[model samples]
Target: MGPDTRARATSESPAGREQGQEYDASPYLPRRGGLAALRRASADCRGCPLFQDATQTVFGTGSPTARLFLVGEQPGDQEDRQGEPFVGPAGRLLRRALAEAGLGDEEVYVTNAVKHFKFTTAPRGKRRIHKAPSLREMSACRPWLAAELRLVSPRLVVVLGGTAGKALLGNSFRVGEERGILRPMPSLEEGEGEGGGLLLATVHPSAVLRADDREAAFRGLVADLSVAASALD
Candidate 1:
């Protein structure tokens, strides 16, 4: 599909989609092997239309055996350019928060619910801004995440935003109402497979960057993540 068609498709409201609709990612999954193989296979994935204009598939990066798996929304402009996740301003903030909460890079495995960067250009054509991934796009890419969760089998899955939370949990999940709490991973349908051991919801680091009080928001994020850190004890 062309850019305009893809944009229009993804711009549809969540309510516009029919109930119980599913997007399949199984065809994009690696036939055999682990994370390395999966990451390589993902680069060529055309599971959704988002890949058409995306710079490249931004796969998960971090320890293969880390006990904590962190899921974010999608790659920002910087990450899209750099071909990695969590390397932009929001990413810097996340790293800082992790440090404050006493968790190092080695302790976490980071990835996004959506592997592709979805964006729209400014009228002036100088800037590209993030566009939230539609539910269909998220669902189309979920199998990769489910595969990661299965491979890593972390003790805790830390959801960093509403997108990631809703993708893993459900549409009814609200980060504001449920942040910082640990919930069991609900069983999935016959084919969907389990995600994480225990799920913890929290605001995305980018939310702090956009907040009125950056300090307070940063601290709150750190506090929420600290709970995940403390869970290790």
Candidate 2:
């Protein structure tokens, strides 16, 4: 079925939010479709106000059947303009770390907890500064992530930051406390069937970029990812 038709099939009511209600993306999700259908439907999503300022919805990319799924916090300025996740400086670092951890490109799928970029503008120039998405925004955008997890059913998921970890695991997830260990995946919702996969949390590559000890941080990220890679063996 087509994306629009599939989206309509999933929801009986029109897509909108009532006053005083939190924004939700579930109505925009397709009842039955693959990644392509989900991607197309997401383009028209008004699930949250973040869409207003973003250039476009940055959806996950990589083989649908990839065994290793990588989740980041959200798209950055470069990802916002390009409409692709992990193409910026941090992405470069992540690519290197993945290689160091022995994870090939072909085995990995990458996405973010939130599809839109939330930012603040600088006073001097038109430079946009990254702002972390509020927990409400993360909650609003979660249906997409849940759908992806349900479809992919990956053997392993490498969470690249606390935000992605919290979005997938729970608000109580702490990367520092939980990094470098494989654990069972949590269901995004009741009866979602998202369990059974292995999950590993780690510092986002952006953290390595901003770190005082860059070499150490990058090594730590690679080490955490290495644990994920070994689990797929």
Candidate 3:
């Protein structure tokens, strides 16, 4: 095959996503008001194919004036059904860790990098299983996130898991190498100072559930979050 053809066949989009599908969230964002309006408008977001199967648009929740902004990969089964981010098993653990780390939900705003729950069903039970969102979807849904950041204007941003890290820090970002250390937030093309929040990369609370040594993983996640708390001082 020729170079251009091979490039198209073998490679992916700017986010290194295979370009499986495309949906845009911008059209729904422009006329929206602040957080509440955005939340309402997101109900109809057809930004990508993910919304096709998800129960509802799981949007960000918390105080708009929050100092700490936390972003996970996306909604899980419970979250999709509840129409709120971080409201599942992972969310419970996250709340516990945040409390232990000296952060509280009142002072924090939580969201997902991709707002929808992407999943596949198991044959036996027809159970929904979590699936990682592609880079294209992340890219597509980013405008909503951008609007969120603009309105919230948080002091710190904590990116949970590799998906969120990749969505913000680029595809090559590794949470293992960068977790706990504060880095400048990557520009979302929102504005000059819009992405200026101190960023902390860490594993999602779900990681603790999947870890062979749950204690170790939980400790590591808490430790990273503690650093974010420290940034508030």
Candidate 4:
């Protein structure tokens, strides 16, 4: 296995985490419409400390008018390097499953719950490990997420893993328990539209790729993606 693959398996912590530090909100966040507005709004989003250690905030990419919206946690190392969300090995898995579900990359907008990459540094090396962002950070970054949701306004929103599900749906949502279930989302806010968007929970692609039981995890992920397809109706 490659060094990256090994790290993917064993390392699961952000490089620099300081929960005590409060993130400052963007005072004059951009209000323009479309993806450009999102880019501008994310520019000064000091909503969390994850932005500090990350190279740059990798925003969501793909078609804005897509019928489906896929939400992940945050950027991985490759994503950080590319300054685009979900462009790594996990992303490839996501793309494959999406295709299998009769969805094209152009048919959905993909993003994350947390906007920035959160990681921890290894004691001996410069490597920054990935860590799950706390609920606090997720909440802090919620505005940006809301903005994206406001624009994309996808008919179906798929929470790709527990993190995305917990942040968008609720904390009690067990991804394992709820995987493949298409549940009507509770009203998020006024701008989120009437009755809110449909929500589905599934395991993150990284989990599938890094698991000891790769086959099981991958199959489970595929099953969840197929559910996403069914949810589109």
Please write out the lDDT profile of model 1 over residues 1-233, one tens digit for every residue: 57775555444423224444455566768778999999998886766767767888999988889888899999999998899999999999999898898886447889999999999989996698899999888988888998888888888889999999988887888999999998876544455545447888999999998999989999999999889888876
Error of 2 at 2 (Å): 26
Clashing residue pairs in candidate 3 are 23-47
Put down candidate 2 lDDT per residue, 69-185, tens digits, no spaces: 999999999999999999999999999999998885547789999999999999999999999998988998999998988788899988999999999988999999999988888
TM-score each candidate.
Answer: 0.87, 0.91, 0.88, 0.84
Which model scores highest in lDDT? 2
Cα deviation of 53, candidate 1, in Å:
1.0
Residue-pair clash count for candidate 3: 1
Alpha-carbon RMSD of each model: 4.9, 4.8, 7.6, 7.6
User: For model 4, how does the per-residue alpha-carbon lDDT over 1-233 read when each residue is reduced to its tens digit?
Assistant: 35564344223223223435544334324756678877766755556556656777778877878888889998898998888899999999888877876665437888998878898888998888899988888877766777778787788888888889887876787888988888786555645544466888888999888899998888788878888777675
The model with the greater TM-score, 3 or 4, is 3
Candidate 1 contains a number of clashing pairs equal to 0
TM-score head-to-head 1 vs 2, winner = 2
Q: Candidate 2 at 156: error in angstroms?
A: 0.3
Compare candidates 1 and 4 on TM-score and give the better one. 1
